[model samples]
Target: MRRLFCLIVLYLLIGGAPVVAADWSLAAYWAKNSPDRMIDILRGLNPEMRSSYLNAMALNYRFHQGRRIHWEVEAQLVRHHGMQDHWESNAVLVARWMDFPWDRWLDTRFAFGQGFSYAWEVPPLEPRSDPEDGESAQLLNYLLMELEFAPPAPDSQWSGMIRLHHRSGVFGTFSGVEGGSNFIGLGVRYRF
Candidate 1:
């Protein structure tokens, strides 16, 4: 009986070890709800050129199944100068690298993802007035690095994130066709 009790206790001890799972959070934009600001600006300068910037934030749920891989779904919006607002959605698979912490309150991460977007534009009063840029659907590739403040309180649930993101495919098929935007953002996150 003594031996059996000892074995049971040993099993309990090993099985009850705390497992640290990769926490996930909802990410939001600091300034705008959509990614269309820069594209709108570009269009304003030259309506003949196809320019669009769409802004988005995603609710990321990460699972630590070996390495850190993130699955994200984002709802985004796009607006161009003299154009109607458009909505877009994306699903991204991201790879994440967690940098060494600085002190006790900061955590930095680098992530990359490739995604696609769809847009429906409101036809201009004079379709010929705004020449079609030719490109309809495009691919988006991005690199993002975020510095986050993770306070050591309430089980480290609250955080503030500062992120820099570079987005491509902002320009349509015509007129050189390649462009992107630089975004500096600040927002809050709640990790679960």
Candidate 2:
């Protein structure tokens, strides 16, 4: 899986179609201890959930253009804190809407993606059983809303963003279990 992800990124960097611009970012996030239904959150239904201390690192690339819609590819690695902990790898392609006008210093975007994920073991969940039903084959879906702060100067290469990362199985695509995960993240992006 790691080899496949590396190859995909290498291709993107060296052989992908030309784009007006591209941005790369690296981020770390903490998963919520109790999972929430994505629909509920999107519908303005907020729930109280605790932090799980599960840490994750995400690497992303955004293919930029002048249009409102753009594309992004992301790869993530997740790890837990205990000795019994395991790692999970997720890769996804996102379609994004980048039209929101927040301010002169910020750019706002919303996106959703579908892809596949693999875990050494089924992620332990609270208040719900394994959505994959102990099977490793899982469909991954994500919703991301991000705020990118503009660079300090016109030609600067550095910027920052805060993002909400929501991951789920989309109501049991594998079986009949409605389960998923969420994280709030901060990242630094470099544009070239």
Candidate 3:
């Protein structure tokens, strides 16, 4: 099943026309179970070290364009706490507000994705049997808000980003699981 998903993503990235750009990034993050609600989680600024840590690598392919919106597909591999952990693949839609006064210094974008994740083992911090209180391995969702710093030159191929990474089940979407996980990550993005 994983092989099939990878093949599909490869096909979409290579065979599809109109895809003009792609980016790859590597990030390290710390994740923990938050007692706070989703909105509260979003409001907090500090990283919590209550659980474990992971490293992630992601490939993003931009395939579509609209007047104010763009679309991309992202495939990510996450190594939880230095162990082979999980794989998450998603189709993401992004919107950037280019008119921000800070554009000369950085770019701001908001992205949302819905996808599936496969875990080598049940997530260490999330409870398994009680779906109403935790998460599931079969399906998941992602949310991100990123600030991409401008490079030294206009044509520079590399940039840095501070991102808020979030994964959740969306309140019983996956067998009644509601809560999930959050990570604050810093990474560099290389455009190809």
TM for every model, in the order presented, reads 0.50, 0.66, 0.68
lDDT (C-alpha) at residue 190 in model 3: 75
lDDT tens string, model 2, 101-142?
A: 653456555666667666556655522454344422234555
Q: Supply the global lDDT for candidate 2.
A: 0.59
Give candidate 3's TM-score. 0.68
lDDT of each: 0.47, 0.59, 0.56
**How many times do residue backbones clash in model 2?**
0
Segments in model 2 whose C-alpha atoms lie over 4 Å from true places = 1-17, 20-23, 44-46, 63-66, 82-84, 126-145, 151-156
TM-score leader: 3
Ranking by TM-score: 3, 2, 1
Worst 10 residues of 2 by lDDT: 130-139
Where model 3 places Cα greater than 4 Å from the true spot, the runs are 1-36, 82-99, 128-135
Per-residue CA lDDT of model 1 for 66-168, tens digit only, reads: 2333334333343323233454444555555543445345555555554554335422211222244333233444445556666545477777776654444
- Ordered from best to worst lDDT, the candidate numbers read 2, 3, 1
For residues 36-131, what per-residue lDDT tens digits would candidate 3 score against the true structure?
Answer: 455765777653444455566767766664333456666777666632255444334444322345556665444555555555565655453454
Enumerate residue pairs that collide in model 2.
Answer: none
lDDT pick, better of 2 and 3? 2
lDDT of 1 at 168: 48
| Clashing pairs counted in every model | 6, 0, 0
Candidate 3 lowest-lDDT run of ten: 24-33
Worst 10 residues of 1 by lDDT: 121-130
